[model samples]
Target: MEEKKVRIHLEKHYWPDEIRARRKRNLGRILALVGLVLTFVFGWVVGSTFATGEPVEETTDFAKLEAIYQIMSEDWYFGKDVLELQTKLIDDAINGMVDGGGDIHTSYLTSEEAKQFNDSLNMGFVGIGVQYYDSNGTYIIERVFRGSPAERAGVLPGDIIFKVNGAEVTGIGSDELAAKVKGENGSIVEIDFLREGVTVSKKITRAPINNTAYGEMIDAETALLEIYTFGDTTGNEVMDILDDFETKGAKRLILDLRDNGGGYLSTLETIGSFFVEKGGILIQQEFINGTTDTSKSSGFVTVDWEKIVILVNGNTASASEVLVAALDENLGEKVTVVGTLTYGKGTVQTQRPFSDQSILKYTIAQWLTPSGKKIDGIGITPDVVVELPAIMENGFEPLEEGETIAPDSVHVAIVSLQEALSFLGYDVDRQDGYYSPKSVEEFKKYQATYGTTVDGVLTQEWISRLHADVARVWHEE
Candidate 1:
């Protein structure tokens, strides 16, 4: 008898540069061939129709679209140059058609937008990689990715971001601020941060960042794995972490998918294989034509865990929800889902690229769980619902420096302060945005314990201290 050899395949992520280069080269040849064929066919059709003198039947609703285009080209007074106007009209037509489909996810993207979309999924954006949260009007750095430009530039968590590129970020949305910070890979961004009552400035060079999954041992037998997105590298990242957990004698698992919006379907299948047995249904898709397709596990079980806990929140959507549903249903009683309800985005979309390098990403199917439960618009309910404090969920109003909310003062900030104080084990009479005498007493107690001035006045410094303490306790928990 001959000995048999088995080969195990691991998914590897390709760098954006190589992937884009290869795509452009192949697409260039394809577009050239397609253009020649389309030109010849269109010329022949027009010539034959004109020669026949027979009316072209309007079989489809859009059959007269070319006539409408001709009318606009010939008669529209405000039309720009022929080529530019044609391009604009074609893009507008595509958008109108897609928008009429009534699905928000099914839309078109320009060439540049398509590139950014792909980069987001591949985790290959060029920027100072830092995640921030809006504290009232102030943006605070919540997380600085390790080995990133921001981390190298001494950007620390809890630092208040004041300005980007000399423009104040006080009134801008987080997305707008991020756009101002991100640029070409070699470009430099000037960031002003308020740290410990001092304004700190840093000039950081942006670079490509690739990060998704992270893991660490939480206790003797428990391991915590946090997956930010189901990107191309996520499978290998999860595998390495699970292997490390096994080596450290950890059996219980806590998979955190809190704000993960999700990414590629292929990555989802790869990660799903670890928890689900081979041939088990991971997800089912029902297409427009009423055909159904099933995705099964690849049978690459990495760890034999005693128990698994999945943490989710409202922002946990799409592929993240798929994983939670698959594990909860397939693993039966062994898996537990905790935290708030997930984001309901259960539709599957596929993209088609145009000759212009633009893309049309349209919904093709609606996904169902293993037990055939439709998750579209109806999110997966967790076994344990652990809602965050109201103030934490909805951010608090910021108090300016030297501004204090004294005793008997009624303000919305008082409500937030009371909530934070209550969460930190301080005794408070009311959390209704009223600074009553009882609230003042509790505030003084907190100040005394934290070694701040024992005055019964709320300052921005005190709020900052309270915020830090709240964050520390939550992190430890």
Candidate 2:
């Protein structure tokens, strides 16, 4: 027994070391499987992100963008030019900010769109300055600018632009349709429209619409002037009207700018000279750079201040407003601002032809009054705000007593008769939305005043006098 105890050093198994080594081997196997799964999941996520097929940001790195672009080009993922893709991206970005739906006043331009945009700014286009958009998935004209080709062709404000040159224009984007309507100056463009319950096909010629309103005189001392624009020539045109008015013995004036959009700044400056005596602050342009001061009568234009009225509405904007503000400040009672507030466009825009052979127009300055009133979003309120009083269907018709008028039909046909009667201050009390006997009587009086044919009916000659009167007084002011 003693010998056995001394000799027995039998090897005991090293259980802890063996078990530790085996555990480590098992952990390595598990880690290998997890890494495989992670690689597969990451690849799937990357693929899905690209293949989602929607308009979205591709990636945030130039290298990623380059790689994706190269793959698309070489792998034939899409059948289109890379430059075209870039152009489309640019167009989409622009349209998001400035398009038919973005701002009715501002729009994005393609090469074709550039043509249409340039045409609009130039006031030169064929298919009547009308634009259409999808409503309930069908296209409809949003509006037709007054005196535009469409309007001249008797196109209504709500007419639908459906076909151009015999092509279905439905779902045709606004930018594309606008391009189709624009063409070489003086060229004819054909359009098919749904107007007043009838589908009419009309061909319209494109030209630069004149910005000057036609002038007319009502009675001596009462002039009616219709202002179309405030272009550079407008000042000279008003001067011409004044010379003519002096001949007609017309002293009281009425300026009508109901549907006139705006134009050049110089014209307003010239207008200010007439009512604003000597050189004072007519209008000041506040730009990012500095303020531009425009003084009154600098070039020596003058106007009669005794009795003048400037008529304006939502359409009167830009330069027309400058005249209103100046006259409102200087002429006071001598000038009567008789309509609603004038359009409050205080910002100035400038156009320059680019070296890239493209032209760009940008907002340059904001306008301020001599009293330093900001002109954007807030128009000049008139002194005597007189609306013709909205009548039935719209009181745009003659203020007759017992007659009813056809909707949207020309009151012009019978308006002269009523307006003539109104001049004698006849029974305009009827305001019956029709031409009546009272209107007839007024018409006769106007005819007698002009010593024209006493037809007892409103004729072109009678209308002419009224228009001239409005043009002389309101427009020149």
Candidate 3:
């Protein structure tokens, strides 16, 4: 296969730099105190006041901590290299301090983790573009980006990733698998995946991925815009789509934010301005210091719509929820939210980078909708609730090539198979895991339509076809 060249785009958001500068300035006094403590604890000097002439209160907590460190470093029999042990001890102490706060969002990231986190928000990485979900320990591809190496290499949605670069991926976390798959641009990654009970390996070249939003005309009058994330260039991508929609005379808009985890807050504000009028409040933030801040639209209404539909699912969260709330509140009944409840992530986090390039991402405030409704644990309920089929949510179970669920068979897997058939418009009598005569009839009908053998028994080939057809229809819709 011929490899296609990919262009990489980099656009920095201003807020990250601003936050870093502000954090550095504010941490000056704290760092000075830390320096004084270190100097006193190491027996460099004993002083009652700080170097800047501020009276410092004496505390024994620092001495106790030093004593523990000394015992661990000098007396512990299993201790390894002194320098390596010291680094590990410091990293653990920082992690323990952050984890002790009882907030899940507040985290301490090592230098490598910090880089990956920032790269994710900026969409700045080279990889075989794909999004996956963790099923127990197995990773299943949920989406394959258009024109990406994965898609070009015959990777498809619903495929089970078995290995990456000859390493078995079972029992591995999603992040670890992703780290294994991603590499330098033009590098080849060997991916082994399970498709229709068959494991196939493909060597795909890594490429820079820039896609965040995709738009298409659903009909002459309706446009469908799906945003995967709100990265740095999301605002610009949204504007270009709106421009095309205007040119095509699309009046009804379907903004699909399903599974969008969200990115920079500045991108949210910029995109929000495209719909909400200037000075209209989009969100309200309540800081830990008992202060509140309001974020308003920037008066950049690029286009107006006759009607709008915002599609959200359980994965829609954070900045995505903010946009849904803003549009629904400001646009009145013209905007409709469909799909299941969104992910409740109302807290705001800010990252401060250390001199060693590690980062501390701490929750600074909790955000509220424009209506002052707090959705921390409570997600935003959709106007029209639409739940996906169980089979789609919890993937299909793997089967051997000749395995067949005969007519009158009753098994738990039959329930999902029935659901999959029903979702594909098959008239299965019931979804109760019983392969009744009617269920067999529906299965035969599906097989005949797809040019498969018209056997009543549900074979692995039929199951794979059914899953692929359902996935295709779901993507189209």
lDDT of each: 0.75, 0.53, 0.74
Give candidate 1 misplaced runs (Cα > 4 Å).
1-63, 67-92, 133-138, 146-157, 165-167, 172-176, 183-190, 195-207, 395-477
The reply for model 2, stretches above 4 Å from the true place, is: 1-83, 90-208, 289-294, 387-477
Candidate 3 C-alpha error for residue 457, in Å: 16
Per-structure clash totals for the candidates: 0, 30, 0
Residue-wise lDDT of candidate 3 within 1-477, one digit each (tens)?
Answer: 896432111112112222221111222222322432221112235664434433335467665556656656776555765457654455444445555666667665656766766777656789998887655465667798767888899888877788888989866866678889888999999999876446889999999987788899989999999888888788999989888988998899999998887777888888999899999999888987889999999988866789999999888888889899999998899999999988888888777667777666777788899989998879899999997777767667645655778888997767877888888888888988898999888888877774546888766555555565666567657
Residue 37 shift from truth in candidate 1, angstroms: 24
Could you tell me the lDDT of residue 338 within candidate 2?
75
**Which pairs of residues have clashing backbones in candidate 3?**
none
Task: Give all candidate RMSDs, comma-separated.
Answer: 9.9, 25.4, 10.6
Give the TM-score (vs. native) of candidate 2: 0.52
Query: Which candidate ranks first by TM-score, i.e. highest?
Result: 3
lDDT ranking from best candidate downward: 1, 3, 2
